[model samples]
Target chain A: QTAATPAPAETWLPTLQVDTPQQGFDLAIVMARRAVKTTQPDVAVLKAQRPHYAGDAARLIDVSGVAAAWFATIAAANGYWRD
Target chain B: QTAATPAPAETWLPTLQVDTPQQGFDLAIVMARRAVKTTQPDVAVLKAQRPHYAGDAARLIDVSGVAAAWFATIAAANGYWRD
Candidate 1:
Protein backbone atom coordinates (compact mmCIF):
# COMPACT_ATOMS: atom_id res chain seq x y z
CA GLN A 1 0.00 0.00 0.00
CA THR A 2 1.27 3.47 -0.92
CA ALA A 3 1.33 6.02 1.86
CA ALA A 4 -0.28 9.37 1.06
CA THR A 5 2.14 12.29 1.10
CA PRO A 6 0.89 15.28 2.99
CA ALA A 7 0.41 18.41 0.92
CA PRO A 8 2.33 21.55 1.72
CA ALA A 9 0.61 24.16 3.84
CA GLU A 10 -1.43 26.62 1.87
CA THR A 11 -0.29 30.19 1.90
CA TRP A 12 -3.65 31.81 2.33
CA LEU A 13 -3.99 34.30 -0.51
CA PRO A 14 -4.92 37.09 1.87
CA THR A 15 -1.80 38.06 3.81
CA LEU A 16 -3.42 38.80 7.14
CA GLN A 17 -1.60 38.71 10.49
CA VAL A 18 -4.23 38.35 13.15
CA ASP A 19 -3.50 37.81 16.86
CA THR A 20 -4.27 34.12 16.39
CA PRO A 21 -5.21 31.65 13.67
CA GLN A 22 -8.67 31.31 15.22
CA GLN A 23 -9.24 35.05 15.00
CA GLY A 24 -8.39 35.09 11.33
CA PHE A 25 -10.48 32.01 10.65
CA ASP A 26 -13.41 33.55 12.48
CA LEU A 27 -13.10 36.71 10.45
CA ALA A 28 -12.97 34.68 7.27
CA ILE A 29 -16.17 32.90 8.25
CA VAL A 30 -17.99 36.14 9.01
CA MET A 31 -16.80 37.74 5.82
CA ALA A 32 -17.57 34.71 3.74
CA ARG A 33 -21.05 34.50 5.20
CA ARG A 34 -21.82 38.11 4.39
CA ALA A 35 -20.31 37.85 0.94
CA VAL A 36 -22.35 34.78 0.04
CA LYS A 37 -25.53 36.42 1.24
CA THR A 38 -24.81 39.70 -0.48
CA THR A 39 -24.27 38.25 -3.91
CA GLN A 40 -26.74 35.36 -3.70
CA PRO A 41 -25.41 34.05 -6.98
CA ASP A 42 -26.62 30.71 -8.24
CA VAL A 43 -25.00 27.85 -6.31
CA ALA A 44 -23.44 26.39 -9.42
CA VAL A 45 -22.22 29.78 -10.55
CA LEU A 46 -20.77 30.57 -7.15
CA LYS A 47 -18.86 27.28 -7.11
CA ALA A 48 -17.43 28.05 -10.53
CA GLN A 49 -16.58 31.70 -9.75
CA ARG A 50 -15.34 31.57 -6.14
CA PRO A 51 -11.63 31.65 -6.96
CA HIS A 52 -11.93 34.64 -9.24
CA TYR A 53 -14.01 36.64 -6.79
CA ALA A 54 -11.82 35.78 -3.82
CA GLY A 55 -8.70 36.66 -5.75
CA ASP A 56 -10.07 39.98 -6.93
CA ALA A 57 -11.34 40.88 -3.47
CA ALA A 58 -8.02 40.07 -1.84
CA ARG A 59 -6.28 42.36 -4.30
CA LEU A 60 -8.62 45.24 -3.48
CA ILE A 61 -7.91 45.67 0.22
CA ASP A 62 -6.03 48.99 0.39
CA VAL A 63 -4.35 49.69 3.73
CA SER A 64 -5.76 53.16 4.18
CA GLY A 65 -9.10 52.29 2.68
CA VAL A 66 -9.48 49.14 4.77
CA ALA A 67 -8.35 50.98 7.88
CA ALA A 68 -10.79 53.75 7.18
CA ALA A 69 -13.59 51.35 6.37
CA TRP A 70 -12.95 49.20 9.44
CA PHE A 71 -12.60 52.24 11.68
CA ALA A 72 -15.78 53.73 10.29
CA THR A 73 -17.66 50.48 10.70
CA ILE A 74 -16.51 49.93 14.26
CA ALA A 75 -16.99 53.58 15.18
CA ALA A 76 -20.45 53.56 13.71
CA ALA A 77 -21.26 50.41 15.66
CA ASN A 78 -20.11 52.02 18.88
CA GLY A 79 -22.16 55.16 18.09
CA TYR A 80 -18.99 57.24 17.92
CA TRP A 81 -19.75 58.75 14.51
CA ARG A 82 -23.46 59.31 14.98
CA ASP A 83 -23.20 61.52 18.03
CA GLN B 1 -29.22 80.32 1.51
CA THR B 2 -29.92 77.21 -0.57
CA ALA B 3 -30.48 74.02 1.38
CA ALA B 4 -28.85 70.82 0.16
CA THR B 5 -31.23 67.97 -0.57
CA PRO B 6 -30.50 64.73 1.24
CA ALA B 7 -29.48 61.90 -1.09
CA PRO B 8 -31.41 58.66 -1.26
CA ALA B 9 -30.40 55.91 1.13
CA GLU B 10 -28.01 53.29 -0.16
CA THR B 11 -29.37 49.78 -0.51
CA TRP B 12 -26.45 47.63 0.54
CA LEU B 13 -25.82 45.34 -2.44
CA PRO B 14 -25.05 42.12 -0.52
CA THR B 15 -28.66 41.77 0.68
CA LEU B 16 -27.70 40.51 4.13
CA GLN B 17 -30.30 40.45 6.90
CA VAL B 18 -28.31 40.68 10.06
CA ASP B 19 -29.86 40.79 13.53
CA THR B 20 -28.41 44.27 13.97
CA PRO B 21 -26.65 46.81 11.83
CA GLN B 22 -23.71 46.62 14.21
CA GLN B 23 -23.33 42.89 13.59
CA GLY B 24 -23.20 43.43 9.87
CA PHE B 25 -20.90 46.43 10.21
CA ASP B 26 -18.59 44.49 12.49
CA LEU B 27 -18.48 41.63 10.02
CA ALA B 28 -17.80 44.08 7.22
CA ILE B 29 -14.93 45.56 9.19
CA VAL B 30 -13.41 42.14 9.83
CA MET B 31 -13.79 41.05 6.22
CA ALA B 32 -12.49 44.31 4.82
CA ARG B 33 -9.57 44.28 7.21
CA ARG B 34 -8.54 40.74 6.33
CA ALA B 35 -9.04 41.34 2.64
CA VAL B 36 -6.92 44.49 2.71
CA LYS B 37 -4.09 42.66 4.41
CA THR B 38 -4.31 39.56 2.26
CA THR B 39 -3.74 41.36 -1.03
CA GLN B 40 -1.33 44.01 0.25
CA PRO B 41 -1.62 45.98 -2.96
CA ASP B 42 -0.13 49.46 -3.30
CA VAL B 43 -1.96 52.04 -1.20
CA ALA B 44 -2.78 54.27 -4.15
CA VAL B 45 -3.92 51.33 -6.25
CA LEU B 46 -6.07 50.00 -3.41
CA LYS B 47 -7.89 53.31 -3.14
CA ALA B 48 -8.64 53.26 -6.82
CA GLN B 49 -9.86 49.67 -6.63
CA ARG B 50 -11.84 49.46 -3.33
CA PRO B 51 -15.27 49.47 -4.93
CA HIS B 52 -14.38 46.78 -7.42
CA TYR B 53 -12.87 44.54 -4.75
CA ALA B 54 -15.70 44.91 -2.27
CA GLY B 55 -18.24 44.37 -5.02
CA ASP B 56 -16.49 41.31 -6.36
CA ALA B 57 -15.94 39.79 -2.92
CA ALA B 58 -19.58 40.21 -2.10
CA ARG B 59 -20.47 38.41 -5.28
CA LEU B 60 -18.18 35.48 -4.40
CA ILE B 61 -19.88 34.36 -1.20
CA ASP B 62 -21.08 30.83 -1.92
CA VAL B 63 -23.74 29.39 0.37
CA SER B 64 -22.34 25.88 0.72
CA GLY B 65 -18.74 26.92 0.56
CA VAL B 66 -19.05 29.81 2.98
CA ALA B 67 -21.14 27.75 5.33
CA ALA B 68 -18.59 24.99 5.20
CA ALA B 69 -15.73 27.40 5.72
CA TRP B 70 -17.44 29.04 8.67
CA PHE B 71 -18.54 25.75 10.18
CA ALA B 72 -15.10 24.32 9.83
CA THR B 73 -13.63 27.35 11.49
CA ILE B 74 -16.03 27.12 14.41
CA ALA B 75 -15.56 23.40 14.74
CA ALA B 76 -11.84 23.75 14.70
CA ALA B 77 -12.07 26.42 17.31
CA ASN B 78 -14.04 24.05 19.53
CA GLY B 79 -11.67 21.20 18.80
CA TYR B 80 -14.44 19.14 17.33
CA TRP B 81 -12.74 18.30 14.09
CA ARG B 82 -9.28 17.42 15.42
CA ASP B 83 -8.41 14.24 17.29
Candidate 2:
Protein backbone atom coordinates (compact mmCIF):
# COMPACT_ATOMS: atom_id res chain seq x y z
CA GLN A 1 0.00 0.00 0.00
CA THR A 2 1.24 3.52 -0.77
CA ALA A 3 2.22 5.63 2.21
CA ALA A 4 -0.11 8.48 3.08
CA THR A 5 1.23 11.93 2.26
CA PRO A 6 1.97 14.23 5.16
CA ALA A 7 -0.13 17.35 5.55
CA PRO A 8 1.48 20.54 4.32
CA ALA A 9 3.07 22.78 6.89
CA GLU A 10 0.91 25.60 8.13
CA THR A 11 1.40 29.04 6.64
CA TRP A 12 2.48 31.86 8.98
CA LEU A 13 -0.91 33.36 8.29
CA PRO A 14 -3.72 31.01 7.50
CA THR A 15 -5.99 31.82 4.61
CA LEU A 16 -9.08 33.66 5.83
CA GLN A 17 -12.50 32.27 4.90
CA VAL A 18 -14.25 34.63 2.51
CA ASP A 19 -17.54 33.96 0.75
CA THR A 20 -17.67 37.21 -1.17
CA PRO A 21 -15.49 40.06 -2.34
CA GLN A 22 -16.66 42.09 0.63
CA GLN A 23 -15.49 39.36 2.97
CA GLY A 24 -12.15 39.18 1.22
CA PHE A 25 -11.66 42.91 1.62
CA ASP A 26 -12.72 42.71 5.23
CA LEU A 27 -10.14 40.02 5.88
CA ALA A 28 -7.47 42.19 4.37
CA ILE A 29 -8.42 45.01 6.73
CA VAL A 30 -8.37 42.66 9.70
CA MET A 31 -4.91 41.51 8.75
CA ALA A 32 -3.67 45.08 8.45
CA ARG A 33 -5.12 46.00 11.84
CA ARG A 34 -3.51 42.95 13.38
CA ALA A 35 -0.17 43.90 11.94
CA VAL A 36 -0.39 47.35 13.47
CA LYS A 37 -1.59 46.04 16.80
CA THR A 38 1.19 43.50 16.92
CA THR A 39 3.89 45.99 16.12
CA GLN A 40 2.63 48.89 18.14
CA PRO A 41 0.79 47.90 21.25
CA ASP A 42 0.86 51.33 22.84
CA VAL A 43 -2.46 53.07 22.50
CA ALA A 44 -0.95 56.36 23.64
CA VAL A 45 1.48 56.41 20.75
CA LEU A 46 -1.27 55.64 18.27
CA LYS A 47 -3.38 58.42 19.70
CA ALA A 48 -0.47 60.82 19.64
CA GLN A 49 0.02 60.17 15.97
CA ARG A 50 -3.59 60.83 15.20
CA PRO A 51 -3.62 64.59 15.34
CA HIS A 52 -0.56 64.78 13.13
CA TYR A 53 -2.48 63.06 10.37
CA ALA A 54 -5.71 64.99 10.79
CA GLY A 55 -4.50 67.87 8.67
CA ASP A 56 -1.94 66.03 6.62
CA ALA A 57 -3.77 66.24 3.32
CA ALA A 58 -0.84 64.85 1.36
CA ARG A 59 -0.59 61.69 3.39
CA LEU A 60 -4.33 61.31 3.39
CA ILE A 61 -4.39 61.40 -0.38
CA ASP A 62 -1.49 58.97 -0.59
CA VAL A 63 -3.16 56.48 1.71
CA SER A 64 -6.44 56.81 -0.14
CA GLY A 65 -4.67 56.15 -3.42
CA VAL A 66 -3.20 53.00 -1.95
CA ALA A 67 -6.66 51.90 -0.88
CA ALA A 68 -8.07 52.60 -4.31
CA ALA A 69 -5.48 50.37 -5.92
CA TRP A 70 -6.11 47.59 -3.46
CA PHE A 71 -9.84 47.86 -3.99
CA ALA A 72 -9.40 47.78 -7.72
CA THR A 73 -7.82 44.36 -7.47
CA ILE A 74 -10.64 43.04 -5.31
CA ALA A 75 -13.17 44.44 -7.77
CA ALA A 76 -11.40 42.72 -10.65
CA ALA A 77 -11.37 39.43 -8.76
CA ASN A 78 -15.14 39.71 -8.36
CA GLY A 79 -15.46 40.44 -12.11
CA TYR A 80 -16.77 43.92 -11.44
CA TRP A 81 -16.82 46.29 -14.42
CA ARG A 82 -16.06 43.38 -16.71
CA ASP A 83 -17.26 43.81 -20.28
CA GLN B 1 -10.25 90.71 -3.63
CA THR B 2 -9.93 88.07 -6.29
CA ALA B 3 -13.14 86.02 -6.52
CA ALA B 4 -12.76 83.03 -4.26
CA THR B 5 -11.64 80.13 -6.39
CA PRO B 6 -14.48 77.72 -6.71
CA ALA B 7 -13.95 74.79 -4.38
CA PRO B 8 -12.02 72.14 -6.20
CA ALA B 9 -14.39 69.71 -7.85
CA GLU B 10 -14.98 66.82 -5.54
CA THR B 11 -13.02 63.70 -6.26
CA TRP B 12 -15.01 60.75 -7.59
CA LEU B 13 -14.32 59.12 -4.25
CA PRO B 14 -13.75 61.04 -1.05
CA THR B 15 -10.92 60.15 1.31
CA LEU B 16 -11.91 58.28 4.45
CA GLN B 17 -11.00 59.38 7.95
CA VAL B 18 -8.31 57.41 9.77
CA ASP B 19 -6.73 58.17 13.11
CA THR B 20 -3.90 55.66 13.13
CA PRO B 21 -2.08 53.17 10.96
CA GLN B 22 -4.59 50.55 11.97
CA GLN B 23 -7.46 52.87 11.13
CA GLY B 24 -5.85 53.72 7.83
CA PHE B 25 -5.67 50.07 6.94
CA ASP B 26 -9.24 49.58 8.08
CA LEU B 27 -10.33 52.36 5.76
CA ALA B 28 -8.61 50.62 2.89
CA ILE B 29 -10.62 47.51 3.66
CA VAL B 30 -13.83 49.50 3.76
CA MET B 31 -13.11 51.09 0.42
CA ALA B 32 -12.45 47.70 -1.14
CA ARG B 33 -15.71 46.31 0.20
CA ARG B 34 -17.58 49.35 -1.04
CA ALA B 35 -16.13 48.98 -4.51
CA VAL B 36 -17.34 45.40 -4.76
CA LYS B 37 -20.75 46.18 -3.33
CA THR B 38 -21.25 49.18 -5.59
CA THR B 39 -20.35 47.26 -8.70
CA GLN B 40 -21.97 43.92 -7.83
CA PRO B 41 -24.96 44.22 -5.56
CA ASP B 42 -26.37 40.76 -6.16
CA VAL B 43 -25.74 38.52 -3.19
CA ALA B 44 -26.73 35.37 -5.11
CA VAL B 45 -24.08 35.94 -7.74
CA LEU B 46 -21.43 36.48 -5.09
CA LYS B 47 -22.50 33.24 -3.42
CA ALA B 48 -22.29 31.31 -6.68
CA GLN B 49 -18.66 32.35 -7.11
CA ARG B 50 -17.59 31.18 -3.68
CA PRO B 51 -17.14 27.53 -4.54
CA HIS B 52 -14.78 28.35 -7.37
CA TYR B 53 -12.36 29.94 -4.89
CA ALA B 54 -12.66 27.49 -2.02
CA GLY B 55 -9.70 25.45 -3.29
CA ASP B 56 -8.11 28.12 -5.42
CA ALA B 57 -4.73 28.02 -3.71
CA ALA B 58 -3.06 30.11 -6.37
CA ARG B 59 -5.53 32.93 -6.06
CA LEU B 60 -5.50 32.71 -2.30
CA ILE B 61 -1.76 33.17 -2.30
CA ASP B 62 -2.03 36.03 -4.72
CA VAL B 63 -4.58 37.80 -2.58
CA SER B 64 -2.55 37.25 0.57
CA GLY B 65 0.54 38.62 -1.12
CA VAL B 66 -1.38 41.72 -2.05
CA ALA B 67 -2.53 42.07 1.53
CA ALA B 68 1.03 41.62 2.73
CA ALA B 69 2.25 44.41 0.53
CA TRP B 70 -0.57 46.61 1.71
CA PHE B 71 0.08 45.82 5.36
CA ALA B 72 3.76 46.47 4.87
CA THR B 73 2.96 49.98 3.74
CA ILE B 74 0.84 50.52 6.81
CA ALA B 75 3.59 49.07 8.99
CA ALA B 76 6.14 51.38 7.48
CA ALA B 77 3.85 54.32 8.01
CA ASN B 78 3.66 53.31 11.66
CA GLY B 79 7.45 52.83 11.91
CA TYR B 80 7.26 49.08 12.29
CA TRP B 81 10.40 47.05 11.49
CA ARG B 82 12.34 50.28 11.27
CA ASP B 83 15.99 50.55 12.19
Clashes (N, CA, C under 3 Å) per candidate: 5, 0
For model 1, how does the per-residue alpha-carbon lDDT over B1-83 read when each residue is reduced to its tens digit? Answer: 23586777544435343333334433444454455556874778757764453345343332223333333333333332112
Per-residue error (Å), model 2, residue A41:
1.8
Writing each residue's lDDT as its tens digit, candidate 1 over A1-83 gives 23587775333323222344445445544544444544443566546555664466452342223333333322322334233
Residue pairs in clash, model 2: none
> After TM-score superposition, what is the CA distance of residue B34 in candidate 2 from its true location, in Å?
35
**Candidate 1 error regions (>4 Å):** A1-21, A53-83, B1-83
* TM-score of each model, paired residue for residue: 0.26, 0.32
TM-score of every candidate's chain A: 0.30, 0.48
